[model samples]
Target chain A: MNKRTVLWTAIVLALLALLVLGCVFFGLFEKSVVAKDVDQPLSPEQMKTLAVRGAYVAVAADCYACHTAKGGAPWAGGLPFTTPFGTIYATNISPDKEHGIGNWTRAEFHRAVRDGVGKGDTHLYPAMPYASYRLMTAEDVDAVYAYLMSRPPMKVANKPNDLNFPFNIRRVLTFWNLVNLPADMPPLDAARLEIWNRGRYVVDALGHCGECHTPRNIMQGMKASEYLKGAVLEGVVAPDITKDGLARMGFDPVLLPAFMKSGISAQGAMTNQMFEVVHFSTQYMTGEDLAALSAYLFDLDKLPDKPASPTQPKPVAVAPELATAARGNYLALCSGCHGIEGQGIPHVVVPLSTNASLRLASARNLIHTVLNGIPGQHFPGLERMQPMPGFKDQLDDRQVADLANWLRAEWGGETPSAKAEDVAAIRRDE
Target chain B: MTIALKKLSLTVNGKAVDPVDVPDTMMMQDFLYEYLNLTGARMGCGQGICHACTVIVENDDGTLAEMRTCITGAHWFEGRKVRTIEGHAKRDASGAITQLSPVQQAFIEHFSFQCGYCTPGFVTGATVLLDELKRQPVARADLERAISEALDKHICRCTGYVRYYEAVRDVILNTPGLIKA
Candidate 1:
């Protein structure tokens, strides 16, 4: 209670208060990124072409898949994305003046997409995939803007996002982005072919194939060590598309372009979300672009190929009921294209007998392929395969189980069979 | 810059509702689920390949035809008599099921559906096939082909074609007038 001690305590408290206030003031006063508008009036033809090119860029980005909700207006948002933090609804990018990006300037839109900075210095959560979009070329961004601006505006409002505690703090995203965004992306090798370089840019940068296919660390950042080896997405495995993985799956490098275009290969078909990606994004890509993508993918480091097929099963006679059902089902459902002896019409229908899907250790892929018929994507310069219709409704659980088992027994060398309960479980999980 | 909204009116599942304003681009699938609250027609593929959003439309020729609602627009269905999966089962005023239609009953008996995403489409398609067959009965020899042709376009993801076919066959054979002995 002495005067000297009391005076000293008061002075210390004042200094501490000033220090805290100074930090807050400095942080709050930090300047935001300035919008750099490149807007210019374009001739009608230029506008049209720019918009058209932008449409392609948007497709390559697969923006519609996340931006649009199931049965909701395209680009009007409302797609709920679930994260460890919470659900974040996509923002409406429609041209509506009030609710969408209609009022946004080119600079504002660009910054929002590339830098994850929204209007008025607001930080957009990473769920927007700005990390991938950040790699988009300026021309691509301009084209996308042109395309979006040309669309008929929808007046739908953006849904508010729901996130948990500290994660909800939008400012916290800056730190997360700083820590996670890949910092060492190498410059494209000038020695590579132009087409190959283009493919690399699209696949590794804009397309962000690793975002889904590569495993994530505990911090939710993509595991760079794993690369695109394979990862679980929404419980279903997004299989390795690496050269080694492809070779093991019996994927011929020559047929990769075709596979990318239509989502079908000698092995089997892409189902579920991969189907959506092919339908919405890759299928629409130009032939040259697809070739480039395939080239880039094929160039990846691969594991040494084994002399013998690991999944190939020893020839064995299947149960009579299963064999009979498979034969009958084949006649009714698959014979038109796959043929009587499971010899698929060359260059048309993919063969079932030697298909890799039937020989996987886990019957999940087989079940998925059988349940969800392989629909072909249209590609220029390729004979479009007729889409395989799903027999999920027409074939009961027992029939599917039998047919699947028969397929493995008949064609897949030394493959295990699937049970009815397995079929039921796959169906239920879906 | 808004897309024009049109007034759409259709007789759905035996009820004729007053015209309601709907977007010109609104798919018939959205019309049934969003506006009419008929969620039976689940959307599988947004495209027409899956046939999971199929509904029965009574043709002017007095034949029942299945339509893919996901690809078709709500405006396309204006003035049409559309029967959804909800219409197949007889319901009291409160919408409690009073009776299951022949196809519904057969489905339950044969365990024809798994996940049941495509059941509505199948039921509607089968109902139409049955109605058409009743108009002109198929001989026993041709029964299998007739069923195949009728239901072949439909896609079932659960790969339940065998049971669905068996159930539909059961209905055709057991029904008094569907098949010629």
Candidate 2:
């Protein structure tokens, strides 16, 4: 231990302390707009009223979709959400004191919903969609808190997340929040109608539609650039719902709201996660709320009811490859249910000619659906679609690709050519 | 325009139905019941969902597969060998029924059907399963699953499905070369 050695050690230690302090100081500059106000004690009547309002708010928020596992107890929360990092199980938000948020104060709940900060100041992962929920008003948070607390508690324990190292650390999420979570939603455009503004709030804030619909950046945060242009989630492409995207799909604004209410219409039937969306959330929305949602989603600047051009479709050119074997395949396996010309039997099969999935440029959804056929679905009314059995084992990848290509050309009209590799890829993902 | 007619020929129940001009739009079920008078495959759902209208079509590769007749056009089965419920049993020159096929006998023994509307379809399905197993036998442990997969598509709406499944299982178990060596 010479004087020079001791001097070097002191200098290194001082620099390391400075670096540590600087990192902590920088984290404080994350510009958090955390809501600290808990709801004041309410009268019994006020609490009841708030809880009732909160019930609708909870549906608008669609908490049930993520929280409830298939056939699992409602609000008990054991649904597993898979991500590139790992799988994260949704937490129990029921009134169970031991397992859920029963003991959580209103202030703590507000922070969790609005600020992405949980009990004990631990940062919640973005899977909670608190970034989108950040737009919710303080009163909305308190109302949700009231509603959740009123639910019957279950003793079901929360499943531990299966994230890899570094992601498993809660401290890492604080930094993730610093980079990802915005301070607040942008100010409402003054030019938009009041109804449109209301709709935007329902979609972006309360509904948190962007969480699944928007594309994610390298950090896996929702990209601010691609707001609602659509992205693939849970093996199915969550189709674009942007105004232009909706228009491209021939969405009548008037009909979309009705579709949202019923989850089935001539345009399309909600399946996959969208089915869960309607079952747990959107179906319960009021007519006015749905109208606003449609207005915002469609971004109708002009009159919504623009009639289409009355023109007949020109015949699509079919390739010899598609015409011979693929056409035979369709007639043998598919034509029985879906008519000879893909003009699906009414109340039996959906028309492939006008199917929204076939119209998409990407063959992912169409290929996936063909490989993994839809289950029997019943809407709010007498309308029911029969279960289409999967043809994964019956049809080879080339056959699936050729069939898709032929169908797209004849019915969907010049969509991308689906390849055998795409079918193979989708098969692997599933 | 006049009703278009097309020449059609196919082997049905070991008898080659000659190239008779039947309407191209006619479904196999309609052709079978109206023209041939075989009348075994009954129309149930018309939507092809109810396998009551199923017929066994022999593939070019000699493999057998069940196909719905209610929705498929008659031309789809043209130039192919098809077997209906009537073809399964043995008969004498006088057309008197002599011996029932193993599937039919098993169904009778298990009481697998009541209304018998779906019996043809179930028999067709089980027959295909038997043919498939003969070609490539499954392990005895997987026989139940094979039977279930083979016959589950046919809706009986009677006899709670356990009897049909039991009957299929009994046929597979009793028969040789069905269980893997």
Write one digit per residue (lDDT tens) for candidate 2, span A1-430. 9999999999999999888756753456455565444645555676677898899899999998888878888898889878888889999999899999888877788888888878887778788999999998777777888888889998889999999988987667766777788777677789998778889889999989898889988998889899988898878898788987776565667877888888876556788989878888998999888888988897854335654542223336777867666776676567777776667877767777667776666778888888998998887767788888778977899999988888777776654478899899888875
Give each model's whole-structure lDDT.
Answer: 0.75, 0.82
Give interface RMSD for all predictions. 14.1, 2.7
lDDT of 1 by residue, B1-181 (tens): 5866778888998899689998765677888888999998878766566778889887677888787777566776778899889888889989899999999999999999988888888898889889988899999999999989888877887855999999999998888988875
**DockQ comparisons of all candidates to the true complex:** 0.02, 0.40
lDDT tens digits by residue: candidate 1, A1-430:
9999999999999999888656543344333232344544445676688998889989988888888899999899998988889999999998889999888877777778777777766788887777666766767877888899899888899888899998877876665566566532357787777776777777876677878877788878777788878776764667776767666566654576677777776665556687778877887888777777767777732212333333544666876766665665655455545755676765556777667766554566766667776666443346455566666865778888877777776776535467788888777864
Docking verdict class for candidate 1: incorrect
Alpha-carbon RMSD of each model: 18.1, 4.1
- For DockQ, the strongest prediction is 2
Task: Give the Å shift of residue B92 in candidate 1.
Answer: 38
Report the C-alpha displacement of residue B45, candidate 2, in angstroms: 0.8
How accurate locally is residue B31 in candidate 1, as Cα lDDT from 0 to 100? 82
TM-score of chain A of each: 0.70, 0.90
